[model samples]
Target chain A: MTLQDYLPCLYALLACAGFAVMFEIKKPMFILLASATGMVSWLVFLLLHDIGSEVARYFLATMVAALFAETFARLMKAPATIFLVIGIVPLVPGGGLYYAMDALIGGNYALFAERGLDTAAFAAAIAAGVSVVTSIVRMAMTGRMNRRERETKKEE
Target chain B: MRAKQVERCLNFCCETGRQLIKNGAEIYRVEEAAKRMLSAFGYSDAEVFAIPSCIIINIHDGERNFTKNVRILRTGSNFDRLDSLNALSRKVAAKELSIEAAEAELHEIMGRKGYPAWISYLGYGFAAFFFTLFWGGHALDAAIAFFCGLLVKAAMGQMVRLKANVFFIHICASMLLVTVPVLLTALGVHIIHTDKIVIGAIMLLVPGIAITNVMRDVIIGDFITAVSKLAEVLIIALAIAIGIAIPFGILRALTGVM
Candidate 1:
C-alpha cells in the first residue's frame, strides 16, 4: 500500500487518542490501546471498502472494532464501552449525517434523502455488527459457565 | 431497628446504581452490579432495575421490603468513574467491602476531578486536526480545522457556563463551524474543501457513546433504556443538522455563494 493509504489510520489513531483525553480516560495505557484499536478498525474499513458495499464495509469494520474492544476490556478489567466508543470513532458516519442536514437546509431534497439514507444505513450496519459480536461472546461465556456447573455437580 | 438497617442497605444499593447510570453505564450492567452488591450485603432478595435516566432498587429483608427510586437528571460518560465503580462492585461481591466502606469509596470517586478543562480544549483541537486529515483534507484544511475547533470549544464552554440548553449549544457550535470556514474562504484564503473542515469539527458533538450504548442495550434486551437513548441520539442529530443548515442557508442567500 502507498503511504497515502496509511494516512487515514494515523489520523484515526490521533483522533481516538484525542477523544480518550477529552473523555478523561485516566490511564495512559488504556488511551494508547484505544487509539490502536481505532487505527486498526479504520485500516480494516479502508481495506474492505475497496471490495464491498458500503454497508458491508461498515459492518465488518464495526465487528472488528467491537471484538477488539471486548477483548481489551477483559484484559484491562474495565468496561467495554470505554474502548468501544473510541474504537468506532473512525467508522461513525459523522460526515454523512452532516451532509444530509446540509442538503436539507439547502433545499436539495434528492441529496438530502440520499445522504440521510446512507447515514442511517451506516448506523444500522454498525449496530448489527456490534450486536453480532456481543451475542457470540455472551453465548460463549454462558456455555462455559454451564459446563463448569455441570462438572461441579458430577464431582459432587 | 432491623427495619432501619434494611432501609440503609436499600439506600446504599440504590445510590450505587444511580451513580452508575449517571456515569453512562449500560442498564444491564448497572442492574447486575447493584444486585450483586446487595446480595453480598445479605439482601439476597434484592432486585435492581436501571434505565438511562432512572434507577429503581427493591430489597426484601424477610419482614419488610424496601424500594428506592433514584432519578438521574444528568448523564455523561467518564471511563475512570465507570472503572472504579465496577471495581467497587466486584469488591462488594467478594465480601471484601462493608456498606460504609463502599459508600466512602464511592464518595471519593465522585469527588475526584477529571482532566482539567484546558486538556479537553486541546483535545478538541487535536480531534479536529486529525479528523480533517482522515476526511482527506490537506494540511491547510487541518490547520484551519484546528483553530475552528478551539473556537467551537470556547464557545461551547461559554454557553455551558451560561446554562444554555444543549440543543441551542449545538446549534450555535455548528453555525460557528460553518461560518468560520465560509468567512475564511471569502477573505481570499485558498481553503481546500471547507466541507471536510466542517465535518471534522462537528465530530466533537456526535453522540458516539450514546449510539454504542443504545446498540448494546438493545442486544441485551433493555429496550426501555435503548429506546430512550435512541430518542436522545436522534434529537441531538437533529439539533446538529439544524445548526449547520441555518447558517449555511443564510450565508448562501446573503452572499449568493455556498
Candidate 2:
C-alpha cells in the first residue's frame, strides 16, 4: 500500500542477487531473472498479507516463485532449479529457525515451541507449493512428448 | 555395437549422470538425461539408476552386458556446471556430437573452474547485509553482518579445504558466525542485534532450497533420495542449532551477559 512496504522486496532482490553470484550464475540475465523472482515472491507474500493463514501465504508465494522459475527456465533454456533456488530465499524461514533455536537454548519452552512449529510449517508449505507446480509441469511436458511421438508414428 | 563403442557410450552416459547429480540436478533429470543419451546411442536396452550419491548404468551390446557406477563424493549447487552439462546432454541426445567430441566437452565442463574466491566472499557479504536489513536489522547491524558473513565464508572455506565433514563444517561456521555478534554485544555495542546478525550470516549455511528439492524428489517417487536429503537438511539444522548454543553458553559463562 505504501513505498515503505516495498522495501523488503528490494532487500529480497539484492539478497537473491548476492546468492546467485555465490552459486556461480554466470549469466547476468539469469542472475537478474532469478533475483527478480525473489522480489516478486516477497511482493506476493506481502500482497496476500491478510490471507487465511500464514502457511497459506507462504504456500502461495512459493507457488508463484515456482511458476516464475519454470517460465524462466523454458524461455531461457536453463534448468528451473537455478531460478527456484534463488527465487524463494525471501520466504525461507531461516530467521525463524534461528530464533527457535535461540529460544530453546534460553530455556523458553513456549517461545521455542511456537517458533519451531511456525518455521516447520513455513518450510513444508513452500515445499508443497514448489512440488505441486513442478509435478504438473513435468507431467504436462511428458504428455506433450508422448503425443508428438504418437503423431510421428501415425505419419510414418 | 562393438565392445569399444559400447564402452565409450557407457562412459559418456555415466559421466553425464554423475555431473548432473553433483551439480544438484534432480534425480529424475539425471536419470532421464542418461536414458536419453543412451537411446541416442542406440542402446534401447540400457538401465540407468541414480540416487543422491551414486549412478549406475548397465548396457547390453548384443553379446555382453557392461555395467559401471560412479560414486559422488561431494555435491553442491554449481549452476554453471549444471548448465553446461545439461546443454551437453541435450546435444548428445540430439545426435549432434560424436562420442569423442562429447567426451571432450564433458572433460572441459568437469575441469572448468568456479568463480574466484573474492567474488564469492563479496557475494556472501552482500547477501548477509541485505538479509539482515530484510529481517529488520539496523544499518549498523547489517554492516556488522556483512563482515561476519565474509568471516564465516573464509572460515568455512578453510575448513572445507581441510576435508572436514559437512556436519562439522556447519557446526564450526555457525559457531564462528555467532561469536562475532555475541562478542560485539559483549563489547557494549548495544546497537547490534546479535540474533539478526547471526541469522543473516548463518543463512549461508542453511539448506533452505534443499527443502524444495527434497519435496520434488518425493513427488517424483524417489523416496530414498528424498529421505536421505531430508536427513541431510535436519542434520545441518541440528548442527547449526548446536553451534549457536555452544557460543551462547561459553560467552554467557564468561561475560554473564550474552
Candidate 3:
C-alpha cells in the first residue's frame, strides 16, 4: 500500500479505535482487534484483489472489514455488529449518496443514477457482508436456531 | 432480523451509562445509573430514555408523575466539573436532594465553557467529506452526506422508541436513513446537500457505537443482549435501504428525478 492507501487505512484504524473509546471500550482488547482489521484489510487489498481500481479497492477493504468483524465477534463471543457499525463508516456510500443528491439537485439525471447505483451496491455489500458472515457463524454454532425459534414461538 | 428490540426490563431500572473518563463518572454512566435507581424505586417500570441532557421514565403507577424536563443540577463534590454536576443531577432526580439545593451548586459547574462531544462530531463530519470527495464530488456535497446521517438519527428518535442503548439507536437510524438517500442519490434524485452535512451529521447514526457496547458486553460476557442489539442494527440498516430504494425507483419512473 502506498502512503496514500496506507493513510486512509490509518484513518480507518484510528476511527475504529476512537469508536472503541467513544462507546466505552474496555482496556486493550480493541487495540489488537482493530489492528488485525487494518492489517487484514491491507493484505486483502494487496494480495487478494486488484487495487488498480478505486471501486475494487473500496469493495475489498469493506469485505475485509466484514470478515474482521465476523472473526472478532466469533472470537470474543460478542455480536459482529460492532465491526459492522464501525467498519461501515469509512466505506459508507457517503460520496455516492452525496453526489447522487447533488446530481438530483442540479437536475442531472444520469450522474444521479450512476452515483445512486454505486451507493446501493456499497450499502448492500455492507449489509450482506455482516448478515451473511454472522449468520453463517451462528448457523454453525446453533444448528437448532431456525427450528428452535419456530418451535419456541409456537409454545409461546 | 426483527429490528426493533423491545423486551421487558427487570423493572424501571435506570442504566447509569458511564464513560471511560479514567476519573469520575461520565455523563452516560450517571444517566444510566440514575435510571436504574428510578426503576428500582418504582417511579418508573421502564427507563423511557436517557441522554446527557434528560431522562424520561415510564411511570408505572402514573401517580407521582411530576416534571418532564431535562434539568441540570450541581453538587458539592469538593472537586471538578463532572463529579459535582453529576452528583447534583442524581441527587435531585432521585429526590435525595431538592431541586433548589442542587441548583445552588450547579452555578459553579455551568460556568465552565466548551464541550468535547462536538469534536467527535466534527471528526466524523470531516471523515464524510473525505469519503465522498474522491467520487468527484465537492465539499458541500460531503457536508450534506454527513448531516444527512444526523437528520436520520433525529428523525429516528421519533420512529424507533428503544431507550436502553443510544448506540443501538444511532446505528439503526443511520443505516436505515442512509439507505434511502444513498439509493435515491444513486437513482439520480440526489436532492440533499453535502456529503458532510448529509452523511457526516449522521455519523452519529452509524453502528460504530455498538462496537464498544458489543466489546464490553463480550468482555463482561453479556452475549445475548450484545448479539441481539447487533443483529437489530444490521437488519434495520438493510430495511432502511429497501425503504428508500423501492419507493425511489417507482417515483423516478412516474415523475422523473423531481
Candidate 4:
C-alpha cells in the first residue's frame, strides 16, 4: 500500500539489515529476504477480506517467509537460522511484551498474566508452524508422495 | 595475491599472540593459527584480537580440540571492515571491535566502559516517572527505587560471574531485583512506591525484549548471526537483575515489607 503504513516493516528490515551487516554475515540473501518479508507481511495484511482474515494473512506471510528461508537454506548449503533471525525480527512481540510488563508492574495481575500467556502462545505458534511447514515441504520433495500407495508401502 | 593474504594472517596471529602474552593470558601460538584462519577468511590487516570465554568453554568442554598449550581467541569478524579496507578501514579502525578475551578479560572489558551514563540515566528517569505514574509511587520512594534498579543491574554484572549460567541468572535476578527494591519503598521503610521505581530503573536488565527478538529472528531463519549478540544482551539483563534483587530483598525483610 502506501509507504507510510509500511514504514514499521521497512524500519524493521533496515534495522535487521544494519545489524546483519554489522556482524559481517556473508549471506546477502537473508537481508533481502528479511526486507521482503516486511513488505510481504504488510501486503498480506491489506489484501485479505474478513473473519479469520487477519490470522490467515499472518499465517500465509509467515509460511511464505518460512518456506523461502528453508528453501534458500537448501539452495545455499547454509544453516537456516541465518535466514530465520533476520526475517522474524519485526514479528517479535515487542508491543505485547511491553504491555505485559506494564500490566505486571501496575498490579493488574490478571491482565498481566493473560498478556504473558498470549505472547508465549504467539511465539510458540510461530516457531512450531514454521518448523512443521518446512519439514512437511521437505518430506514431500523426497518423492514419497502418495497416501494410498503409502498405505501399501507401509504394510510392505 | 593469495599468499600475501596468508602472510597478513600470519602477521596477525603473531601479533595477537604477543598482546595476549603481554596481558598474562597463559597463551601460546594461538595468534599464529588465528592469523591463518583470518587470512583464509580474507583478512589482510587483522593484526590482533582477544579471545572470548565462550570459545574457551567450547575448547575445555571438548567441543573443539585445539592443542592445550595454546589458548586461542575466538572472533566473528563481519568481513564488513575487510571489504572496505581500501576505503573505510581508516574510518572504522578506531572503533572498538567485538573481539574479546576469556572470562576475566571479557568482564574487564565490560567493567571498564562501565554502564554508559545515558543508559543509567534513562533507567533512573524511567524508574522515577514510570513508578509514580503507573504504580502510584511517591517522589522519594521512586528515587530510591530507581537508584536501587541501577545498583541491582550493576551488581549483577559485577558479582554473578557464572559463565553460561548468566541467562538464567539474569532472569531470576532481574525478576526478583525489580520486584524487591520497590517493595522496600512500598513498605515505607525508605519509600513505599519503590518496587515500581526499582523495576523501571532496571528494566534494561531484562533482556526479554532482545531475547524475544533474537528468537523471533532465529525462528524466521535468518541465522547469519545475532546468536552471539543475543548472548551478550542476555548477560547484560542478568547483570541488571543481580544488581537490583539483592538490595531489594535485604531491604524488604529489614523494613518489615515482607
Candidate 5:
C-alpha cells in the first residue's frame, strides 16, 4: 500500500533483469516476463512471510514462481527452466548461506548451526515446492493428451 | 540399403543431445529431444540416456543398430543458445527440418555469440546493487556492492580466460567480495554496511542453476545426476565460504578489523 512496500518488488525486477542479462537471455520479451515473474514471486514471499511460517514462505513463493515459469514456457514455446532459473533468483538463500559461513568462520558454533539449518531448510523447501508443482503439471498434461488420444481412437 | 541414412540421422540426433546437455539442459529434456528427433527421422526405436556430463544414444533401423556416446567436458548457461537449440529440436521433430539442415542450424546456433563481456559486467553490478537494496541496505551500501560486483565479474572473466579451475574461480571471486567491502569500511566510508554489501555481491556467485537443476533432475528420477549436482553445489558453497573466511580471519588477526 505504501512506497516502502513496493521497493522490494522494484528491486526484484531490476535484479531479475540483471540476471537475465548474465544468463545471456536473447529474447527481450522473455527477459521482461522473467523479471515480472521474479517481482510477483518475491512480492508473494514478502506477503506470506509476514503471515506464515518461515518454511512456508519460501515453499509457496517457489511454487508460485514455478507456476508462472511453466505458464510462460507454454505460452512462449520455450523451456520452463529458462524462466524458472531467473524467476527463483529472489528466493535463493544467498544471504542465509553467507551468514552461516560467516558464523562458522567466526567460531560461533550455535549461530553457525542455526544459520546453516535455516539455509538448508529454505533450499529444501524451494526444491519441494518446484517438484510438487512441476509433477502435477506434468501429470495433467499427459492425462489430457491421453484423453484426446482415446477420443480420437473412438471416433476412428 | 538405408543404413547410411539412418547412421547420419542418428549422429545428428546425438549431437543435438550433446549440445543441449552442454548448454545446461536437464537430462530428461535432452533425452526427450533426442528421441523425438530420432522418431521423426523414422527411427522409432531410438534410446537416449543423458547425464550432466555425457550422452549415450542408440538408434535401431530394422536389423541394423547404431550407438554413439558423446562426452561433454564443459557446460555453461547461455539461454539464447538453449532457446535456439530447443527450437531446432522441435523443428526436427515436426519433420520441418532434414538431418543436414538441422546440422547446419545446430552449427549456427553453437557459433552464435552471447552478450559482450561488458554487458555481463554491468549485469553483475546491477544485480549486486539491487540485491543490496532488497536486503534492506541503504543507497551507500548498494553503491559499494555494485562496484564489488563489477570487480568480481571482471575477476571471474579473467580467471575463465586463464583456464583456472571452477572452484578456484569461485574462491577468488568470493574473496574479492568480502575484501572490497571491508576495505571500503576501513577507509572510513561509514555509510556502507559491510555485511549487506558482501551478501549482495556474493549473490553473483551463488549456484542458482545447480540447485534448480538438482531438484529437477531428482524429481525426474535421475538420481545420479541429482546427487552429482548436489555434490557440485556443496563444493562451490564450500569454496565460497573458505574464500570469504580466510580474508576475514586474516584481517581480524592482523588489525582487529571486520
Candidate 6:
C-alpha cells in the first residue's frame, strides 16, 4: 500500500488528541502517549483489513488499545478509562449508528435492521475485546498480590 | 471506633465513591476504592456496591448496622479529576492520610475546574476536522466540520448552562450539527460532502465508549450496572438519531430533497 493508506492513522491520532483535550487529560506527556495508542490500534486495524473480517478487526484493534491503556494506567497510576476512552474514539462506529437511524427514519426496516445489527455487533466485538483484556489484567494482578501475601505469611 | 467516628468514616467513604462515580470511574473501581478506604480505616467488614447512578456502603461495627447510599444524578467524564481521585484513594488506603486530610483533598478535587470553554470548543473543532479526514473526507469537508464541531460545543455549553435535559441537549446539538453541513452544501459549497461532515461531527454526541465500557461491568459481574449503562447508551444513541433525522425531515418538507 502507498503512503496514502497510512494517512488515516495520522488523522486518528490527531482526533484522539482532540478528544483527550475534551476529556480534560492534564498532562501533555500522557495525552501524547494515549493518543499514540489510538494511532497504533488504527494502524493495526488497517493492516489487517484485507485479511480479517470486520468484527475480528474491530475486536483485535480494541484488544490492542485496551492492552495499551492497561499498561499506561499501571505505569502512570491513573485510571485506564482515560486512555481507552480517547484511544477508541476513531474506531467507534458513528457512521453505522447514524446510518441505522437514517434507515429507520426513512421507513426502510430492512436497511435499519442490517445497519443496526452491524453496529451492535461491532460494538459488541469492541466490548468483548476490552473485557477480555481487562479480565486478564485483573487476574494477573490478583495472582501477584496473592503470591506476595503468601510469601509474607511464610516468612512470618 | 465510636459511633460518631464510624458515621464520619462512612460518610467519607460514601463521598469518595460518589466522587469516583461522578467523575467517570468504572463501577468496579468505585466499589474497590471505597472498600479499600473502608478497610484502611479499620472497618474491614464493610461492603460497597455501586452502579452508574448510585453507590451503597454498608458497615456492621458490632453494635449496629450503618449504611449510606449516595445518589449520583449525573456523571461527567473528567479524567484529570479521576486521576487525582484515584491517587487520593490510594494514599488513604495506605494510611498515608487521615480522615481530615483526605476530606480536605476530596473537597479540593470536587472543586477542581476543567479547562476553559474555548479550549474544549477548539478541541471539538479540531477533533471533528481530523475525524472527517480520517473518514476520507476532502479538505473542504474537514474545514467545514471544524466549524460545525465548534458550533456544536458552544451550543451544548449554552444548553448545559440552562440546565436542559441531556437528551434534549444532544438532540439540539446534533440538529445543529447536520443543519450546518446541509445548509452549506445547499448554499453552493459544491466541494463539501454533508455525509462526511455529519459523520465526523456526530462523534461528539455518540455513546460508543459507554457501550464498550458497559460490557466490562457485565464481565465484572455487575449486571445491574451493565444493564443500566447499556440502557443509557441506547437512549443517547436514539436521541442522536432523532436529532439527525429532524434536519433531513425539515429539508425534505421545505424543498423536497435532502
Best of the candidates, lDDT: 2
List TM-score per model, in order: 0.96, 0.97, 0.42, 0.41, 0.96, 0.96
Q: Which ten residues in a row have the lowest lDDT in candidate 5 chain B?
A: B182-191
Report how far off residue A69 is in candidate 4 (Å).
Answer: 0.8
- Write down the worst ten-residue block by lDDT for model 4 chain B: B53-62
Rate residue B3 of model 2 by lDDT.
92
Off by over 4 Å in 2: none
TM-score of chain B of 2: 0.96
Give the range of the ten consecutive residues with the poorest summed lDDT in model 2 chain A.
A98-107
Q: Model 1 segments beyond 4 Å from truth?
A: none
**lDDT tens digits by residue: candidate 6, B1-258:** 499889999999999888888778889889999999999999999989888888889998987999999899877878889899999999999999999999999999889889897899889999999999999899989998999999898998889789898789889999999999878766776777888999998998876457766967777888888888888898888788889998888777777765
Looking at chain B only, the TM-scores across the models are 0.94, 0.96, 0.38, 0.40, 0.94, 0.95
Native-referenced TM-scores of chain A, all candidate models: 0.95, 0.97, 0.69, 0.72, 0.96, 0.95
> How well is each residue in B1-258 modelled by candidate 5, as lDDT tens digits?
488897788788878888888776888889889889889998888888888888888887677778889898767888888888999999999999988899899989988988988899899999999999998899989998889989998898889889898799999999988998777666777777888888888888988888888888887788999998999899999899888887788877877745
Candidate number with the higher lDDT (3 or 6):
6
Error of 2 at B104 (Å): 1.3
Model 1 chain B: weakest 10-residue lDDT segment is: B183-192
- Candidate 4: count the clashes: 32
Question: Which scores higher on DockQ, 1 or 5?
Answer: 1
Candidates 1 and 4, the one with greater DockQ? 1
In order, the candidates keep a fraction of the true contacts of 0.81, 0.70, 0.08, 0.08, 0.73, 0.77
Residue by residue across B1-258, what tens digits does model 1's lDDT show?
A: 888877877887788788877776888998888888888889877878788777888887786668889998877778888888888888998899888898899889989998888898888899999999999898899998888888888998899889887678888888898788877777767646888998988898888889999988998898998999999898888888887887777777878876
Per-residue lDDT of model 6, residues A86-151, tens digit only? 888888899998888778767799999999999989888888889999999989999999999999
Per-residue lDDT of model 2, residues A51-95, tens digit only: 879999999999999999999999999989899989988888888
Per-residue lDDT of candidate 4, residues B105-128 (tens digit): 323422332235455444334433
Instruction: Candidate 4: list runs displaced more than 4 Å.
Output: A1-3, A27-30, A45-58, A144-156, B1-165, B168-258
